[model samples]
Target: MSSSAPNAVLSVSGIGKTYAQPVLSNIDLTLLRGEVLALTGENGAGKSTLSKIIGGLVTPTTGQMLFNGRAYTPGSRTQAEELGIRMVMQELNLLPTLSVAENLFLDNLPSHGGWISRKQLRSAAIEAMAQVGLDAIDPDTLVGELGIGHQQMVEIARNLIGDCHVLILDEPTAMLTAREVEMLFDQISRLQARGVAIIYISHRLEELARVAQRIAVLRDGNLVCVEPMANYNSEQLVNLMVGRELGEHMDMGVRTIGAPALTVKGLSRADKVLDVSFEVRAGEIFGISGLIGAGRTELLRLIYGADIADSGTVALGSPAKVADIRSPVDAVRHGIALITEDRKGEGLLLTQSISANIALGNMPAISSAGLVNGRDESALAQRQIDAMRIRSSSPDQLVCELSGGNQQKVVIGRWLERDCAVLLFDEPTRGIDVGAKFDIYALLGELTRQGKALVVVSSDLRELMLICDRIGVLSAGRLIETFERDSWTQDELLAAAFAGYQKRDALLHEAAPRNTL
Candidate 1:
């Protein structure tokens, strides 16, 4: 009765997709029950498109798919879910306005006599949250109140609630903390024990070796390789993912450092950024590293005047201290630009044309007598498209149609067109591919070479170590320490990042009296 390959849980053959061009072509892959397949590729290499086809989000141009040795073509997400197939997409689908308990069991909330059972919901939520190390969070708390990393965990927990045989996790740990990642790994192990087939998509090479039994490398819409994880070392995996050898890090040659380009002092925000202070030198890259909810993003928001700081002083340029940045306009006028962390919300206008979006932050430059020059805007967009190497059919294309990486490039391209003296990048490479990431790195180096100061915030510790001349650690809203490139080690950085939370726990124990300290 089975039409699929023997013992295969899911099978895809001759799958192809075309957009402005052929994004994916003649693809074939199979998933086996109780096995983990690590799916990896550069951005826009058709990994997400292929995942979308399997998840019933996007119809493939041409392909045949089978699940459990039977013809399986899901018409919609609901159909796939009904067939015991689920996907945790990179862009979360949860309603942020709802409570954790509500979002987790939204599809099948407990009800009796036409009344919702809050008591049962709390119990179920606690159990599910505990699985992902979110036990301490209140179930009734709104998901909007959670940070990005916490929200990611909530998304994963929601997926695990139902009967699932095949699950596709796209960039599952991209925003997770170290501890949260460990909890996720544990959950994956349990799922494997229960005979679940998992297709794990991630950019972190080390994580694949830990969770995936087999690795499948996709490049340029083709199945480049599928081999045992042990068969491919980290370097070899990178080679396959990008179809070339990539160095561990790019070396930015030595340069003369100028006076401080931007200086921040006494930066404080209620319960988010506390007494943060730092100075970024001209032609140098400074990095900030910390755990999720450790105030890294909040600190950048404060400096850029996106969020009001309770107490702070921001001075731009060497020896010429200027007015405080009370608004984003003030920050911009002072030659400060912030590439925000949320590309979907803060960084882009997805519904607008790519040319229009790029003209957003550069209106003053692109406009003539208060009216934007259409020809100039198109030319500007075209210049950036070439410089950023964005893959797009035309400047008239909507931003939403492009991949995440291309959209990010548009954001950076906007600032590059400006004459900003200091650039603040928040999680700049969050979901960028290795190739695109290196390009951004080279761009950063080029920016610094032009004497522009750069402040970069990233969750990847290795990335911070490699790119920044100096790095600062933010732990629980406090700037714990800063270290030169030669001084910072992974262990030391992690220790500094986790120090605040450890001290807070110790203080609570001492105050509790039962656990006297």
Candidate 2:
């Protein structure tokens, strides 16, 4: 559709953004009232850049925007919000120290005579929280106490509070549960009924097909296609996004399976993880699949010594001798590495250069007598840059400058420099695109070929089935069942994931007293 179309609620002409180099170029797009538009592309394809431009997070270098056929130039996010435009970015923006209610209505708190009205705030917060399936959480509770998934919901609820004519959601479901995703979709439907335009960005092809009315695929900072969602299938959409045909199956390189490399026995950490026991053999990939709040991450944290296990033993090697791992340093000494889900927060030092970040754990190799060797650090970072095919200008470039996929590569490169016996990956391909996901899968294959034991935790069941030799299902803080690669089906795995919760709910119902008239 053209920018002058009557139904267009917002339109951009010749939109582009640049930082050190051109990222977005000559983008012309229109958002119609009461319609969902899907924006998709590979990592570093400038989708986020364009959205930021529209949402006033970033100013366009060369473009003009029109809202309802009038000139619209927002200098800041607050200006955009005042103009009824909102964006929910992938990286959450919330005050962890403040209560959920405060964070939700911080800009426009309900007050009387310059004093905050707790009653009014709580009532309004409850109404908003219920729409996003967060009614169980107390509004007075600090946002820091909630999990990442709930924080994402609160961010969404905050944007949904005031008037919003155009809403942009960037990977909104990346940290959300299946039920929460449905609730968000229901809210989206309600907003659509109110004539609110939406721009939905995600890597999941199925969700795009379900929620988007029109699909726009960007590649290499260019707009390639804009068509109705029904015009293309998932495969076609992926092909358009990546500019190549990708197969559904993967060819994992052959490797010899050896004795157990890492074993956990009776691992329990409060109610988050309960008596979890598993073994990952050398050259084997053990996958963990579970719904949100099922304690998948907690189990990984305990194994990596990031969290203490109340009662458990972590044994290493074939003879299986228990290792005394109390902290991350000890875990590293014992040859265990964890690639955290919060890569930005835990994995990399964004303000530092690529060489500096890679030199973190490999200080011994890059330093001499309490001094870092510049040449050695550059060489180390360059090796991984070439090996992982990380697209960066130079080793001196800051980690914050790279895209999501490239940043993840930097994290993996740091661990690859070490001879770790076991590797734990939490949502390795969480926010990456389809092509980048395959890159990670291939890396896992290479790691296994090198006799490294790998444990992967993913929210996507299909991902586990694709790369895992054996998959373990976590349900309600317990390991429900483990399924072999070929022996498991989607339906069976999902059923097993919910089994523990079902049993717990049944017992709770049976224990409750019933009243009769």
Candidate 3:
């Protein structure tokens, strides 16, 4: 739908936010009615700050926000909602104890005078859920009973039911399946038809190309560029976002495959992970690529012992059989490390200092007689920080204060300190910028040069193609296929990832039982 008609739906002019230091400066953005504007940048590039300003979660230190060509400043979330603006954050905000229906129309529950109208509320909730392609979830079902993907859908449904004219989604597809992402795109198309201006933010540049008409780039608290999607490719978009050419195909010669460092046999995790098996060779860069919910992350979690496996045997070099690693500590002791996908929630201690977080995994090295050697710790932390090129005010600064890229580096530094022989990185570059991504790739290469085995799980096929020696593809909790780096193109990888290896054969097999019956 073309939004070339007169008044813009939302206009942000000279928007500047200054915390203790400048967060965003002299920014200008416009969202036309029915247009999807993708806001993208490196983590800590002030994109979230800008979104908060629009959603009224934060008041700009300077400048103004105009809605319908009228000066508008929402003092609170309720005010923003009242003004037909709503934000669906990356982190879900649903009450687990409440039913799906209750979470859907939480703000304006249907009521007759002073009494509640439960029946009307459920009907409305169903309608809203239908809009987001989530009709399977019962309205009365407790939110806690739903999966993460379902809960995400509930959040999106809630915004739609609010009759929001302006919708802001921050990293909405970060954890959604391919089918779920398609469902969301369909909903966005419908919302656009109704003249709802959307501010879409995500680390996945490819999705932005598909859904957004215009793209805005932010870098270091400044609006660097804004242009139509027709004018840019993935490479150009990344270049603009990071202000540098992220070198094509990082050097991987440093890591040469040797004997197996770790091996998994018949790994099973109920329905999500089924008879999965893989091996990581020392000094090799192994990658796992799959659509969300394909069991890649789950398999990694099982191997790391973050989650229990009903059946599996893990061998960690030297004829040692690890029966069952019940916890992360056991995995660590076996020289295995897993960098979690949710860096904020699982990987880093945001409130702690960078030095403390970086040194946390290798505390024994700095401890003598149960006393930490402060000087030794500082030196070790500083060495890793310099090597990783972590951009921070100081090692003493809280990790929460660093950019997403820097924080990720801190996490990597922690694992590096442990001198782990095997490392599993899940979405290691999800929220980081292009420049930092290159740095991480280089670090991975360096680690492998030192004979450390690495396994990377990523949603971006291009990343896997560029950095990994071999790639494994998963679909529906099954290990569908594997490919050497030279064996497949990005298009082929994506095809296998989305369509699976034997679609026709699988369908034929499923139909065989029915045909015989």
Best by lDDT: 2
Residues 1-517, model 1: lDDT tens digits: 1335566899888889988788889888888898899999987777788888899989888989988877888999888988888899977778889999999999889988889999999999999999898999999999988877888899999989879999999989888878788889999999999999999998888899899999998887888887889898888888888888988868876766789998988899998888988999999999999998999988988888888989878888779595578889988888899998777768899999989999998998789889999999999999988887887889999998887678889888889868899999998887788877888888888899999999999999988888899999999899999999898899999999999889878988788867445
Count of backbone collisions in candidate 1: 1
lDDT of 3: 0.83
Query: Model 2 over residues 84-195: C-alpha lDDT tens digits?
Result: 9999987788998999999999999999999999999999999889989888889999997776778889999999998999999998988776778899999999999999
lDDT of 2: 0.90
TM per candidate: 0.95, 0.96, 0.88
Task: Please identify which of the two predictions, 2 or 3, would achieve the higher TM-score against the true structure.
Answer: 2
Model 2 alpha-carbon drift over 4 Å, by segment: 513-517
Best by TM-score: 2
How does candidate 2 fare on TM-score? 0.96
lDDT per model vs. reference: 0.88, 0.90, 0.83
Off by over 4 Å in 1: 1-5, 320-322, 511-517
TM-score ranking, best first: 2, 1, 3
Candidate 1 global CA lDDT score = 0.88
Range of the 10 consecutive residues with the lowest summed lDDT in candidate 3: 1-10
lDDT of 3 by residue, 1-517 (tens): 1223384898888999987789899998888989999988876788878888898888999998778878889998789989999999765678989999999887788999967799998889889899888886789999876655678888988888756899999888766767788999999998999999999998777889999999999988898888899999889887888777776767766556888888888999887888888887899888998876678888988988888999977788746466458998889888889988666657899999988987788889888898989988888889888887786667888987776667778888888867788999988876666677777888888889899889999877788888898898887777777889799887677777766536745877888867565
RMSD in angstroms between candidate 2 and the native structure over all alpha carbons: 1.7
